[model samples]
Target: MEAITPFLNANQQISVDIKTLREAPDFKAGEVDIDIRNVTPLFLNQEEINAHYLTTYKFRLYASQAYVEEKGIPQSIHDLDAHTLISFTKDGLFPHTYEPQAIKCKQHLIIDCPLAIANAVENNVGIGPLLPHIARLSQQSLVPILHNQLRQSLNIYYTYPASLTQNRMVQDFYNYLQSLPEDFLKGRTHLLAKRPQKINPLSDF
Candidate 1:
């Protein structure tokens, strides 16, 4: 909702498909119009597609206060091995390098989407990596843990078919996205941050 609400309200007769693409979509076949992915494809053929540097997404470990109280805060990264950890399937740190195996997460869950990961954390399912902005989606506040230790910075790319570079709609939306600040995408500019937070109940039922 955060990324497309404005565009949806401003435009009409447009369809958008948002997902994590493991392989390049057949843009020419109209399989997809635009793709915003955190990891740049290792074999992005510059000759066929255009990849523009988007923004860097910083992910930190987050766990609901309830989860912390139940499982206890992981004092060290290794401590995560003893607790439930949620993460994307591959858990790639960067575009150039992907995780060779499911080693990052030592426990039950391999969510394929970041939004789902946030939901899992909000429900006190497990500690997982999430962008700061997505943290606000939770009804209850989620605390950042090992902020200094468990942090991931991945660069996102704005990709489209080289042939459609001149298309008005594509250019218009891309320009609008670039006009927004990096903080806006990362949750630094959210209303929840500015508003006074409601007090959490003192007792956990």
Candidate 2:
């Protein structure tokens, strides 16, 4: 919505649907014009769908200022025992390498929507994992927690029917989305391996 909202006129309308797709969609049927999803091995094994890489995201733990003030900061994964954990449903769907770790929380707030999870965390619900860009939208109310020790990754992909390749508007919109993430992709790790970093204290809330 952030990307498409700017250019809309007053009378225009737009809709977005979020789902965990079980199979490659029949885009030729015209139920929807475009699809965006996190790349998975299932997406790789299918020949019917063509997934275009958009950008990679690092999912790091965050706590709102209000949360930290009440429960104190968690500097390690072990520290999370006392805290509530906010997470998404369908946690086991992705391969470990392509997705983030699914934690076992003492107190869990499980929701399917990423935006909703961010809002819950922002409202001082619990510590949750979110991409930095999403957390930045929190206006610094969310503070990074145990960032060096625990993290997850997601690779976003854009898809459409191979049939749309030559259509001008679809092509242009896809091209625009492709270009939008150039700056966001910097320093993001799509790689499964990386050098280790030194641990630090969680001081700032």
Candidate 3:
């Protein structure tokens, strides 16, 4: 959203209302200009909505240092059952397909917010899946668990009215999104891994 702020400021005519897509609001009302979602909308065939492919994000299971010390790292999927698990309350957005049912059944704590889940894991509440970008940003050092085996990915999409495809502001925002560099999202993950400093746990909130 910050990437296109300058354009929005200059245009003055274009405004954006960001909302979670899970609530199933009326996008056809003509008031909502763009709807960005982490998952694909179920009503894509509604004829009024046009979805645009944004980008794909990679995710991995992460555990706090304290949790790892206590439970030890999970060597395999079967071993995960022995450890406490942290997960999102919404099953649809769990992000892992390898062992979706198994993981869901083993959740020790169900959290609605992603940041809260990360914080809980940092505080040694449990192990959970997180995007590399989010893991790097957290104040706690999250060790990647089952990194080689439990990798997962999700695609992000933005939807708008087909009729608004020709709108200059909409086109400009879309173009700005496409202009982002390939490594732009992963740069922090790589940099953080090499740093020796520890992050303050309080800053995570």
RMSD values, in order shown: 11.3, 12.5, 10.5
List per-prediction Cα lDDT, in the order shown: 0.63, 0.58, 0.60
Candidate ranking under lDDT, highest first, comes to 1, 3, 2
lDDT of 2 by residue, 1-205 (tens): 3444442232133222333443444555643445555656776556655567777667777889999999999877778879988766435311233344555557877775566778888889888877777788676578888878877677766665566555454455456657665544332111111112211100000
Pairs with backbone N, CA or C atoms under 3 Å apart (clashes), candidate 3: none
Error of 2 at 196 (Å): 54
**Tens digits of per-residue lDDT for model 3 on 55-105?**
777867899988899889888878887888776554532543323454443
Q: Candidate 2 local accuracy as lDDT?
A: 0.58
Q: Return the top candidate by lDDT.
A: 1
Against the true structure, whose TM-score is highest? 3
> Using TM-score as the measure, what is the rank order of every candidate, best first?
3, 1, 2
Candidate 1 residues 19-126, lDDT tens each?
Answer: 444665566665565666553455365677777776888777799999999889877767777788776655542122354433454566777656777888899998
Off by over 4 Å in 3: 39-47, 90-100, 104-107, 182-205
Instruction: Return the TM-score for each candidate structure.
Output: 0.73, 0.69, 0.75
Q: Is candidate 1 or candidate 3 better by TM-score?
A: 3
